[model samples]
Target chain A: MQTYSLKCYKCNVTQNDNSISRIFCEKGCNELLICEDISPMKQDPLQSMRDDEESFSLGEGSTPLIPLNKIGKRLGLEKLFAKLEFMSPTGSFKDRGSSLVINIARKERVAEFVEDSSGNAGASLSAYAGATDIKAHIFVPDSAGKGKLDQISIFGAKLHKIEGPRENSTIAAKDFSKKNNIPYLSHNLSPYFSEGMKSFAYEIYSEFGEVDHIIFPTGNGSLLLGTWRGFIDISENSNLSLPKLHAAQSSIIEPIVAEFSQKKWNFDPSSKTIASGISVSNPPRLIEIVDAIKNSNGSATSSSDNEALIWHEILAKEEGIYSEKTCAFSFATLEKLVKSGIIKKNEKIIIPITGSGLKETT
Target chain B: MQTYSLKCYKCNVTQNDNSISRIFCEKGCNELLICEDISPMKQDPLQSMRDDEESFSLGEGSTPLIPLNKIGKRLGLEKLFAKLEFMSPTGSFKDRGSSLVINIARKERVAEFVEDSSGNAGASLSAYAGATDIKAHIFVPDSAGKGKLDQISIFGAKLHKIEGPRENSTIAAKDFSKKNNIPYLSHNLSPYFSEGMKSFAYEIYSEFGEVDHIIFPTGNGSLLLGTWRGFIDISENSNLSLPKLHAAQSSIIEPIVAEFSQKKWNFDPSSKTIASGISVSNPPRLIEIVDAIKNSNGSATSSSDNEALIWHEILAKEEGIYSEKTCAFSFATLEKLVKSGIIKKNEKIIIPITGSGLKETT
Candidate 1:
């Protein structure tokens, strides 16, 4: 297997290509790093390899790009499309990352893995882990949806529920990884995992070819980052410029939006949002996220909890796509952009319905 | 356009091919009569036509034939595969029927449609109806899950909540259809709707070639009837006898099982079950269901509420398929069959999981 060297975001120092699964800048610093040189193998050869490999794919990628025909017409737009990521395996887009992460871990000879997620990520990781017959330990908030918890448990993963808040799960997962001497397959910190998400962008580009603007719900910025990379790859290799990217956040926890508008990187631990997926008070990839926004000529917008819920209802009723509040945040922001003329009515726009509404928080 | 005459099941009379969407033996008769003479176009050609026309599809058919490896090993069975139908469009097997039903309705120029369902069927119909831009009015039991109700409501369907038992919704839908002069597109009664379910049988046959036993949870018998037809077609074309079919029902609604054991043909209005989808007091295609069961050397079994719940958890924990209570009914029946020596250890078995766990009934 081909390998690459890890580079620290903080120190800008490249590390030796050790056989380690994950590496950080120093002993105690939070500056995580992963080998970024790896690219997708040639399509034809990869397809042939997969065909001959006795593939155990659980039908992970290629979600639907359902047309919002009536909604688009009603909004006075010529066309609108919502990529239904909720239709993915484990009922969330996280499955994209989980599939690749578990496969890589298997190749690395890792027997066990640990992850922390509010719900969707845990379920996704647990499912892929189950598929590969690897031991998986998931840490989740006690307040996570029972259905989501049931999903993770069904995958035979050992669940450790932290009682206090969302961040508690992360603390517990990290602690468990250390004590058990297992690799912490933290999705928030895994760049390799993020590579799997590039497929989402490829699917969109393959379908629409040239979207003028792309709006997405963001928390850890994985979708935005992966999409930006995908579009960049397409633009560089093909004959197209990347679409203007827009990240949607809940106003209650609009850290990225706050940072973008002020041109400052500050962590507000007090900020919170009912759109739990994006309720990141401190996103780990803040620098890359800011760079992505700047490079794509994108702006960050925030939606209120009420707005997200209302739009969730509208998207479901009008477009026949039932998505969670996190996914609805994108639509809420899109409406705002359209109202303010930030998004042109004639411009082709795409939004991603990130997770299924079946896992309702309420 | 091609049309077929409606033959009455009770009176053995044929009706003229009027401009009607559905037909019954008599004006007051509960059973629907479908013209078997309306030969469908060749399956391969139809599939090719769909492939040529559609721009985006998730490869909805060809679900996994997951071996109940651990459970089967425990039961001393060499093979037992569960057809994961929950991974269909709209996250349920109903998508198959809904797709066909909606296509036929669109072709027939039906402007308005109404149906009553506990959950999955309503959501499925609403989604396809929304896709085709047909007005959908769904009558659901008031006791339906909030999530399911929200799903139907999100699909922009007019939701009527029937206050009494599950069957009340069907009565309400029928009454609404009559009063409004709209077509009652019953998922249970429509032959065209059930045709989509033939894909399940085709998938199983393609995977295992020759299954000795096929088990499924009995609801409206759409899955059972469709698979039977598909297998019959395959058997006729090939040189093999049909597989033995096993219909699993909730003990609370043991109408089919009771009828099978006694070798009688009757309908009882009082048979009710917690498996809300199969709580139908009188399935319209009851005779056809009986015929399919008898012809395949099949047996009927009813699972208790406790058994269903237990198996539901087992499937989620062991198999990594978070199915609802109805799905458990199939596994519960399979266990019973194995214990009773009705199913041999060496025979290949196939079970179809009908819907997703997202539709949780409290």
Candidate 2:
């Protein structure tokens, strides 16, 4: 196996040891660590990261990339594609990350772990944990939809319905992990989990070769960061240039968009958006996400709940893609990008339809 | 395109016409028609059937087949596989047929079509219809889950919720089609729709090469007949023998099972099964379904509601496959097949996880 090192996202301080437990920099920078390769790049980047036996999969990744003709015509774009990330084993793209993180936990002989999610990630981790015969304690916001909660419990995970805001669930999971001396497998902070998302970019490259732009429905922006890393890895071997990676978020909870666009925005507890998956008040890897957008020369945008809901229905009616309201944010922002002349009408674009509408209770 | 003919399932009378309208036998035999290839079979059977431009798709078929290790161990089987058919665009295996059926309808220049389904097929047709911009009238049982109803309506299809028995929906759909002069695109009766399921068998052969047994949660048995036909087509080219194709049904509504097993069974209006997807009392192609089972050297079995529910939970917990209650019927019957010594412990087995559990309202 090739050796890897944990490099701080902000300071670039490298740690020789590549441990799953070491999520943050030891230099007190309080930034998430990224897996940096020490050995020469292999033909297959995933194989270089981990062996097939050490990896577990519920057949995540390799989702179908389809043309969005109706939606594309509606938006007056010549080329538009949607990666059906919702058709994954767990009905969400989070399976890509969960499979990798849980596989590592299993390899380390960890019998139990804790995680906190609004919905998709919890259900994803719970499913992966169940598949690997590991006990998982999924801390979810009590306000989380019944569909997701049921999905989590159905996979035999121990459900911890934490009361209060989404952040409270995160805090509860951390406290429980610390008290119980178990690892907190936060999908947001885990380097291994993020590394798994690199497959999305690879798959995009494999299918479309290279597109002009790629948009994401961002919350913690793990997928966005991983996609950037994947493109970077591909660039090392091929002359393919990086696709402009855009992050689409709900306007009511637009931390990344607010910072990137230099617009005044704040979290309002009283406010709510139908796109709950991206309703992150404060993302931990905010700097990393911004850095990726800056590096790709991409833009971050936000849309109203109504616009997202409208596009959600449009996607179903026009493109036959019944995706969650969160996924609609990309199309909602795509329209704005096109109107503003940032994305040319003829330019090729791809959007990852992050989760299925079936996961929505409403 | 190569010329095709429609052969009666019962009388075996061949009609050279392959029109989408000719669903029933022209000789007034009241039997369903099956598409028979007139041209020499090509390397790709699907290509031989329809041209790329003529076919519409929502990225259906080519689902991942994964090993069910924990369930295999519990069932005392050496090898067990599940084709994750639920991961299709519409969250059901029905997408395979809908794509072909709707594509044919589009080519026929049909303005509107009517279909009756318990849930999955209706949603599948609605999605494909939406993509093609064709008007679809989906008549569903009023007792159908809210999730499925919402799915149909979300795709901009007109939904007709019929009251009383499941048969009422079928009656209403046929009546509406006749009254409005719209074509009845009955998924169960459509030769093209059933023919589309051949891809399922082709995928299995491509992925695993061959397996001992393939089980299905049967309702109308379109997938079963299609798979059998596909295997036959493959056998013509390769030396691969047929896999015993079994049909698993709900004991409460077991027309295929009753006929195949030579047991006394009747549909009871008072009785109920949680496996609603396979709750068809009278399947249109009943004789054909039975013939395929017998020809494949396979048996049909039924399971009680409680048994199916238990296995459904087991599948989610053990294999991390969150499938609908209908899928549990296959596993329930598999246990019986193993206990009766019909299936050996070392033999390879496969079950198609037909639909996603996320579609369930309860």
Candidate 3:
């Protein structure tokens, strides 16, 4: 068994036990739990998070990393690639996190759980929960996409659609979890969930040997932080330097970008963007996300709804990549990076196509 | 550089050249063409169909082959596997075929082409055609799902909504192609499209060492026929034997099943099923499909729409696999096979989840 501990990044307090209830720090720091100090373990990276028998999957990882030939030429980059993360079983990258989170839940003998999401994570969690015969109560904003809502319900998860903003759904979910005594298995805060995303970084390393940069479609920053941790894990005894992990968010909700760039930005309730996946007013993992960006010497940028939609269409019509609208944030960011001479034309860059276009209604 | 010839199954007529126009045998054998005399090629299997430079991919192959433990237990089978073929670039197994068809079209310097599909193939071909910058006129039935139609147009394909039965779309597409001087790249009839599906079988062999049986959700039998050919390719000069390739279809449209069982059955225009992907009344490759099943010592069976939906739900709620309703046909067929003692509980079986449930509207 791989030995690891859940340590609070803020308080630096470590807990060796694997429990779903240990979400935040016991020091009242309210920071998310993270796997900090770990013994150099087996070659199997999945063992870094969950046990062998506890390893559950819906064929989540090993997504395709294809060269974006047409999109690259248009963006003035000679080597731009897209990791088709949306080609997952549930048609999103959340499957990776869900696999780990639900696996841990199963290992801990948890019977039920509650999770909140705009859409992707809820559907993903519901799917995994169904596989394990664990009842799931997914709370989503009433405004979540019809496709995602349908997907959530299809997996036999009890749907709890809350009114108003995405935060309302989260609040309602937490209340339900506390009231019903169900474990709140939030993908954002769960260390195992983020730990599952480490597979993405490892896959990129294996496929490309070395990547110059990776611009993610950021929301709560689970993927970003996990990828950073993943790169760190791989770079333990090697001369390999971590890739510059860039963050691309919607201008409407650019908490990570604002913090990284030291710009004054606030939540605007009225603001809406086509990139609904990253429409987060407040991300709980803001500190870790910002730290990763700063530590990797990566930049954070935001794009408007119009710019995002334009890139989304270009990905479909030009490159035949029918990714979710949120994916365009990375392309919009890439264009700016190219024009500003931050990312050179010859350097290899990767963008994760986070979700499928099929998940988004036209 | 991989030498091959398009040989008519019935007439013994062979064409050495690769041309999109030569779909049928010139000697009035209305039979579909197949790659017959393929020379022993290099190490790469992709080169068997298309040249290295002409190869196009949206990362279509290498789908997850996961063991269906829960569903297998329910079906009294100890070893049942599901090849999540729906985890393709276009959310369907058709992408494998589409990759080759479009690649061949691009190599032939075809600027424009017309194709007809129920939904999956059109969306798949549209995406590939978009990637290659080829103008595609996709004729789909007006009754096709809204999700599929949206997907077709999203890739910038000219969507021709044909009225009446699915046959109407094929007739309209062919007529349009003839009038516009564009090659009709029909996914059903194109040898290149079916040739591309050979990869599916090769992948299964690589993953499982050897599969005892494979149940395909049959439409035009592209996947089924190609998989058989793939096994034949690998079994050449070896002790390896081809797996029993079974065909599963909707009872509403059971042409192959009726013919295989020597039952008197005919197509009914009013017949409808939720499994829209396999609602082919008249499969042009019927003869070849029957031949493959018989030669491989496989059976052709079908299930009712009610049964299909039940299996579809069982897969989602029980197995946590949210696949299209068409995939249920395989499960329904499997149940029948198990009950009839044709498929022993101990033998390994594989079913391809051909498309994503996200593509289906609730």
| Each model's lDDT | 0.75, 0.86, 0.86
Residue B343 of candidate 2: its Cα lDDT?
Answer: 91
Check candidate 1 and list the clashing pairs. A154-B316, A316-B154, A317-B154
Highest DockQ: give the candidate number. Answer: 3
- The alpha-carbon deviation from the true structure for residue A21 of candidate 2, after best TM-score superposition, in angstroms, is 1.9
lDDT of 1 by residue, A84-117 (tens): 7777657788877777677667667788888998
TM-score of each: 0.86, 0.97, 0.97
In the range B1-362, model 3's lDDT, one tens digit per residue, is 35557988887788655586578876676777887536675222454443465567788888888888998888789999999999999999999888877776787789999999988899999999999899999998898778889999999999999998888999999899889788888999998788888888878877786788899989899999989988888787557867999999998899999989999898888877887888888889998999999999999998999998889999999888999899999999999999999999899899999999988855
Q: Choose the strongest candidate by lDDT.
A: 2
TM-score of chain A of each: 0.91, 0.96, 0.95
For model 1 the TM-score comes to 0.86
Q: How far is candidate 1 from the true structure (C-alpha RMSD, Å)?
A: 4.1
Model 1 Cα displacement at A247 (Å)? 1.3
Please write out the lDDT profile of model 2 over residues B99-153, one tens digit for every residue.
Answer: 7777777877887889988888999999989889899999988977888899999
**lDDT head-to-head 1 vs 2, winner:** 2
**Between candidates 1 and 2, which one is better according to TM-score?**
2
| Interface RMSD for each of the candidates | 3.3, 1.1, 1.1
Provide the lDDT at A236 for model 3. Answer: 79
